[model samples]
Target chain A: IAGITQAPTSQILAAGRRMTLRCTQDMRHNAMYWYRQDLGLGLRLIHYSNTAGTTGKGEVPDGYSVSRANTDDFPLTLASAVPSQTSVYFCASSDGQGAEAFFGQGTRLTVV
Target chain B: TQLLEQSPQFLSIQEGENLTVYCNSSSVFSSLQWYRQEPGEGPVLLVTVVTGGEVKKLKRLTFQFGDARKDSSLHITAAQPGDTGLYLCAGWANNLFFGTGTRLTVIP
Candidate 1:
């Protein structure tokens, strides 16, 4: 299996700009998630989807948005980038709630 | 926010040595998982412990979940240089909450 793949492996943006991090999984999982990993900190959830069409806000969703249009894709959007939003973003998918979650390679974003 | 804490943030040891990494939480979870990641890559699942007081082994690595379902540990026996990477523990709350991660460096 191709497992999980994330787009724009790394990016640099100016403040107030917009960006979207893309994630796709071929595992056909029902739950998809977005998380941000900061230096020396644990992975913090940004958003999640229970299935193809449902999405929910997570711990750190203030400046981010997400969409789950199908079983294979989840895109996380940063509406207005800020320096505090600079972190590596990870995408994960699980077959069911509380099940094993497979993660994508993650996108390293830097907002200047 | 549900938090997963990992201990000994960083560890460095000789090739034949052993070490253990821990992940603890204050909330209950149905399942706990362990993952390993190298520089610039996504985490890869290592083991999943579902039952309370569960124990699972993957080669030289042993994984255990606390009886209360809020803690877990990963022990590596006779570590190798290839084991050098970031080890992370995760549990599902609303989604997956990853631990702070233990960066291990096994020297030859």
Candidate 2:
């Protein structure tokens, strides 16, 4: 069973462009999170959804937004990409708070 | 904001050598999790420690949570090339906070 899936395995976009990273999970988890990983910076949470129709900002949420329209999907959108946003984005889901999380194959994004 | 700090940002050692990585934080956590990520892939869960002073083992890897619930450690015995990856520790407060990470390379 595909636990979690992330789209656009890799992408390169010019600055000021718009991009949306798609994530879907079949585990029916109640909590989902988006994180960006960079060299020496580790993984920083960008956004999170507690459940369907509820989203919250994370440690790094300035240039990104997320929508949780349903329990199976959480999409992260960059209204206008910037060079600083170039990094590997990961999508994760857990059964509930403080539970072990399962991550998807990351999306490598390069904003030039 | 709670911050998790990992020691020895990078480690490279010969195969069969034993090593330990640490994850420390000033704030207490309800639970702690460890993950390993290889190149071109997302971090995969390794283990989770909930009770303070708990110790859990996975094959040759042993994980321990501090009695105060503010720190944790991962120890690998007789490391192999297949164990090379980025190791990260995450603490769960109201939300999960990740450490900077320790990149481990085991040379065969």
Candidate 3:
């Protein structure tokens, strides 16, 4: 009842199409992150927001963009989806110190 | 970019066996954490070790942080089917960097 929530549990998108993954947390944490989980690659950071209205690129930020319009929401958008962009996306939140991260269930997206 | 590499990408063992999974990195971290993830779900934090050479235990699972703060390990005693999952290690600096992860399967 009090944690991160990711919408569109799973999706299938055509190539060159646009898609957005929604993430919302009720904890009001200061930090939010987006990551893509692939087979054998683990979870690679896509984008991160230290606080409201601030965003930074992570290890793999290509083809993806994120905006932290407010403390409760951080949405990841794929301007033009590709086959390689298909993967499980996760949203996580941590405190200001970045001690521990609480994650959402994840969204499974497939680009064909 | 800092990379955390986990050894033995995948492992399958019989129930009641003991096993160890290692997470190695060249970059020293202020802290390290372990997480367990099951299919169709996100990873859940298991333990966090900050100080170098620190060891923390939770039930049958023991976690150790390298003295140099660049590596860590998880040892499970008497593995059980319930312990089967993908184990991940993350290093903490200004942000968190994760390893490739080790998938473990325990058979009954």
Candidate 4:
């Protein structure tokens, strides 16, 4: 089962452009998250959705936004990409709080 | 924000050798999780220790969580080359805070 899958495995976009990274899960999990990994900085949460119709800001939420329209998908958008946004993005989900999470392959975004 | 500090930022050793990686923090957590991630792949959970002073074993890997819930460790015995990956420890506060991963390279 493709537990979780992210679209646009890698992307290169010019600054000031808008882009959305797609994430989907087949497990029907209730919690979904977005995180970015930078060298030596660890993975920091960008945004998260506790369930459909509800979202919350995470540790690093500026420059990024997310929406959870249904249980299967939660997409992260960069309305105005910047060079500082170059990083690998990951999508994850859990059946519930404090549970084991499954992650997507990842989206490597380069904002030039 | 709660912070998790992992030690031995990098580790390289030959097969059959033993090594330990640590994750420490000043903030107590309700639960801590361990994940191993490879290049091009997202972090995958290896295990979770919720109880203070708890210990869990997965094959050759032994995981321990400090009673104070402020530290954790993973010890690998007779490590194999397949064990190479970035190991991370995460602490939870409603959401999880990941530590600087310990990159392990097991030489064959």
Candidate 5:
């Protein structure tokens, strides 16, 4: 069973281009999160959704957007990519607040 | 933002040696979790500590939570090459905040 699946395992895009990272979970978790990992700077939250139809800004929300259309899908989009946005992105989910989280493999994005 | 700070951003130890990694925070939390991420993969939950001053063990790894719920630690007995990875500590407030991370390398 695929707990969480992320698409485009790796991508390289030019600046000003639009890109979307897809995340899907078969666990039916209510809470979903998007995080970016970089050297020295651990995992920084980009955006999160407590439940379907709702989304919230995280610590590093700028330059990114997320949409939770249904329980199983939460997609993060970059309106216009920038070089500084290059990082490994991770998608995670949990049953509810404060519960154990499950993470996806990751998406390596390079904004050149 | 409530920050969780982990000591020794990088660690290299010989196999069969014991090591302890720490995570400290000024803000209290209801619960804390530890995760380990191997190269090219996302972080995976290793353990969760809820009660203050609680300790849990998984094989050779032992996890402890501070009495104030603001700190935690993970001790691995007899480090192995398989245990090499990036270790992170996280706490849940409004959202999950992760520590800088401890990259451990176990050399044989």
Candidate 6:
């Protein structure tokens, strides 16, 4: 059903560059989230959108931003990539708050 | 900030062995969820426990929520090579707070 689709499955970017990780879901979920997974440091929420046209900061919101223009799309952007930002980024969505969340395949980002 | 802590960050065992993983937190949660992630993939939900002291079983996996709803445990019996993956616990306190995750490797 293509529950969630993420673009640029893997990317290698130079520091100080701008990048956007695209995420789209067909489930029409109202809540979407962006998280980064690093070794020894599970998934840390970067940003979240309770519904379209609204967004909020998560645990690790620095250096990252997200926009939920509609129910199906929530994109996360890195204003200026840094080497420390290299990690696997995951996009997830749920029917509503506290519901089981389904995640995208993931975007492997490597900044040099 | 609410934090979920998972013990034994990594584990390796022979196939058919039994093992247990733990997830603990200082804050109480209305619900807790368990997820498993394999290489090059995102975490996928395995089960969710809503009530305190609830126990749920899924084939060889057994999940239990603490009476206080501040802790959880996952026990796998007769593990197989296919059971290898990263196990994560997430608690719902307004939002989901994920644990550090336990990486399990079952060798044949």
Residue pairs with colliding backbones in model 4 are: none
Per-residue lDDT for A2-112 in model 3, tens only?
699999999999999999999999998999999999999899999999999999999999999999999999999999999999899999999954378999999999999
Worst 10 residues of 2 chain A by lDDT: A94-103
Model 6 DockQ vs. reference: 0.71
Per-residue lDDT of A6-109 in model 2, one digit per residue for the tens? 99999999999999999999999999999999888789999999899999999999999999999999999999999999999999999887888899999999
What pairs collide in candidate 1?
none
Task: Give the DockQ of candidate 4.
Answer: 0.68
True contacts kept of each: 0.76, 0.72, 0.72, 0.67, 0.65, 0.72
Q: List TM-score per model, in order.
A: 0.95, 0.97, 0.98, 0.96, 0.97, 0.98
lDDT of 6 at B25: 94
**Can you tell me which runs of candidate 5 are displaced by over 4 Å?**
none
Lowest-sum lDDT 10-residue window in model 1 chain A: A96-105
Candidate 4 positional error at B31, Å? 1.0
- How much is A48 displaced in model 2, in angstroms? 0.2
Candidate 5 lDDT for residue A20 = 97
> Which DockQ-derived CAPRI band holds candidate 1?
medium
Off by over 4 Å in 1: none
Question: What does candidate 5 score on TM?
Answer: 0.97
In CAPRI terms, where does candidate 3 land?
A: medium
lDDT of 2: 0.94
| Residue A89, candidate 5: C-alpha displacement in angstroms | 0.2
Can you write out model 1's per-residue Cα lDDT over B18-37, one digit (the tens) per residue?
89998999988888989898
Q: Candidate 6: list runs displaced more than 4 Å.
A: none
| Model 3 lDDT tens row, B28-88 | 9999999999999999999999999999999999999999999999999999999999999
In order, what are the TM-scores of chain A for the candidates? 0.97, 0.99, 0.97, 0.98, 0.99, 0.98
lDDT against the true structure, each candidate: 0.89, 0.94, 0.94, 0.93, 0.94, 0.94
